[model samples]
Target: MIDQLSLTNFKAFRSADIPLAPVTLLTGLNSSGKSSVLQAFVLLRQSYDSSTLFSSGGGLLLNGELVELGTGLDVLHEDVVHTPGLPTPLISIGLRTSEGQNFNWSALYAAEQDVLTLHSASDAQRTKSVFDRRRFQYLKADRIAPATSYPKSHHQAIGLGFLGASGEHTVNYLRHHARRPLTSKPLRHPKAQTNNFLDHVVAWMQELCPGVNLEATEIPGIDAVRLSYGFDGTAGLTSSARRRPTNVGFGLTYALPIVVACLSAGPGSLILLENPEAHLHPRGQSRMATLMAAAAAAGAQLIVETHSDHVLNGLRLAVKNGAMSATDTAVHYFRRRGLQAEIVTPRIHEDGSLSDWPEGFFDEWENSLEQLLD
Candidate 1:
């Protein structure tokens, strides 16, 4: 899991070192640098997979252009309109094992010099790398930009460790993995729970459209597997009712990726998500948060960027209900001061309660009172 992330010359962050826990929640106002934290991780992962620093052109691109990596001191401000010459916009991430082994990696770009560099902790050497950086999966709100292909399009097989950000191929991935036994490896889920997992996914959809069941079957002429949601009437149904993903409500499609991704992620895998609660009802959002908490408990590291109070409350409830440990969770709030942003970590108690409530921290009452006072 990521133990610490230090940003220098990255967007909104000049120089900041934030500690990370197993399950970290990043909450803040829009553009307060919350998303940048997730972006930093995505970039780090991309660095590992890329052959050159700016080659792959994946998540690192912002607004259809490469992200400018400024010098470290450039982001720091001495006072209004007075800033020191910045250092290279270098980003460093510190990772530690449960046994306390630490690994640090850094990346930067020099526009004037037209060069990008990547450095690893153990290796004293710095080298220019390509865009095809390391393999790090991310689920952002605007997952892949308009020009990029679907995340899974590059993969030949359906379930070989490929999960798209939009989770487009989620159902297909699940179906493909479910059919084959992993080679010489014990199945992770018990038969009963595996069945329950499928049932739960379909059942959640059924709430929106009753009597629905998801089935994975090969098309008559195609080699690809497809998922179809079937609906039936009461007992002794008259006709078979089924629909493609396009026909069902988007919520079903949106929630599918989150559920499948959580179930599929193993230890040491990093799952970065932006607003998993999007398109979900309050109840469904709460349930989704619980699912994520469970994944974290099972050793998958999750960093979620969310704007949902329901999601936060659900995580707290999960901790209270023994679904997650308080120690495994960290809630960081991003607050902006002029051009710089500050991160505040909230303390979660043993009983899943918050120790401090910062101003404007999901408090609707403040808005209500302001309106009245105004």
Candidate 2:
């Protein structure tokens, strides 16, 4: 797993070394650089997949599968530093693995060009395994909404085990791997009917909405899959009746990819999630955090970008519930300072309390309560 990420002259950061943990949470105000951090990894992964990362062309592909960072000027830090003799301010992205291997890829800036040329770098091949398609998943915030049909991509869903940045391939992936036994202890839901992946996914989704069950089925000849929800007992919808995802709540479809991603994790897997609590209720948001904690306990590393305090409390509750260790978690509160972004990390204690609570760090509720009392 990557132990730390270093950004130099990159967007929203002139220089910063961010420490990562088994389960890292990035929380802060809008555009405070949380997404930028995840984009850095996706940029490398996509560039590597497209044969642009270290090819003879040997450059960073700004527009690719996972991210489209645009021209150098768009990504370059506004207050970029100028070293003594370099022609252009180099933007660098590097990572140090827990195994102690280091790889830094620096590129010289070009105003109009989308791809940036690498100026200097260490041996990048030694760390190539970190970007393996099977071991990584980056889910962006604009996830799939409630829809009757979802696209099916055999190569991405089955071959690469990717759910897409928008999690568009989730239903197909879930359908293809439904019967696979989930061997990871921490990830296995206790209430699951069996050890199957689909059961575990349904069990976890029940936390968001009790008695809610799902079925992902192939849609005839076309490259598409259909997702339907079935509520248990004689309620609004009968257990025997199948309802399209379009008729169900948006939260279910939006949260499906995250649930599947967490349940599908294996040892050494890396998941970068953006707004995992999107469309979820407060209770369900907290439940999502615990599910992520379970993923970490199962040996996957997760770097989550969220704005929900419920997610934070849920992670805390996970640690308190012994799902994971406090040492395995890291919480970063990002805030914009002038023209650049900065991070303030708070230490999570074993008892689920934080060592420090900086201003504006998940304190909105307390602030509001105080105002109401006044």
Candidate 3:
């Protein structure tokens, strides 16, 4: 997996080298560059998927399916650095693997152009291994809400195994892969009856809303799929009828893609999540963290951006509970200094306690209590 990501003259970072682990949690205030890190991964993968990064006229496509970064000027660091005589500073992105191999891509700056031409290298093997759509999944913060039907793209869902950046194809993908065996023991929810993917999903969702179960089915004569939810003994109901996603409310449908993504984990899988805790209750958010840790223990590498302390505490709980090795996790607290983003890394101990907690790093609860007492 990506052991480290280096950004030079990229958005929100003049120069930054961010370390990654089996499960890396990016947490910080709004606009503090947490999402920018995930965007870089999507940017590279999007460029590669469109064949723009490796073609003869190589370039980084700023606007693509996964992200829309606009012109080079929009992403170029305001305080760009360059050689004394150089008029322009190139935007460079570097990915270093755990095996010590480095894949670098640099693009020339253009004021208004969307595609920035690149100075490419023949590191195709390593690059493909990192960005190949089949092994990668990116779920954006603005995910698909409750919908009657979701798009079904065979190439994206079944062929590439992508749930889509906004999870627009999740229903279709879920329907197609429902029966697939979940061989990752760590990812299999204990309460799940069967070893199939769908049952595991229900068992996980049941944590948020007890007795909640969902299904994805194809719509005949259309290139779409529908997702529905049902409850058993929830709110004193014996067995509720399958209802459209619209009727079940936002949290369940909104969190479905994340559940499916984590369950899809396996050796060499790379999942980039933006706010996996969004719209979730306190307990649900924390449970999401445990689910992610399980994904890491199952051999997938996950880079998650979240703002919930419950998610943070859940991760600590996982480490302490032996769900994953403490060494396998990294907690980064991000905050802006002037115009650039600064990151502080805290080590996770065997006891699930942090080695450091910088100011404004998930300390609001205590901070607020102090004020209340005063």
- Between the candidate structures 1 and 3, which one is better when assessed by lDDT? 3
Pick the winner on TM-score between candidates 2 and 3: 2
* Top of the candidates by TM-score: 2
Cα lDDT tens digits for candidate 2, 1-374: 88999999999898999999999999999989998899888888877888777776577888977788999889999999876699889989999999998889988899898888888766667766877779888899999989879999999999989999999999999999999999999888889999999999999999999999989999999989999989986376787799888888789999999999998888899999999999999999999999999999888999999999999999999998888999999999999999889899998898999999999998988999999999
C-alpha RMSD (angstroms) for model 3: 1.3
lDDT of 1 by residue, 1-374 (tens): 66777666566776777777778899988979887788766555444444243343322222112233444333223222212353534544444555555555544544433224553233323222211122234676743221111223335225245566556555456665654432211113332223444654554445434465666555455445566656666444422565665655566666666666676665666778888887778887887777777677666778899998888998999889887788888999899987788888887876989989988788886789999999
Clashes of 2: 0
Ranking by lDDT: 2, 3, 1
lDDT of 3 by residue, 36-94 (tens): 89988888888899999888878889998889999998999999878455577888888
Candidate 2 backbone collisions, by pair: none
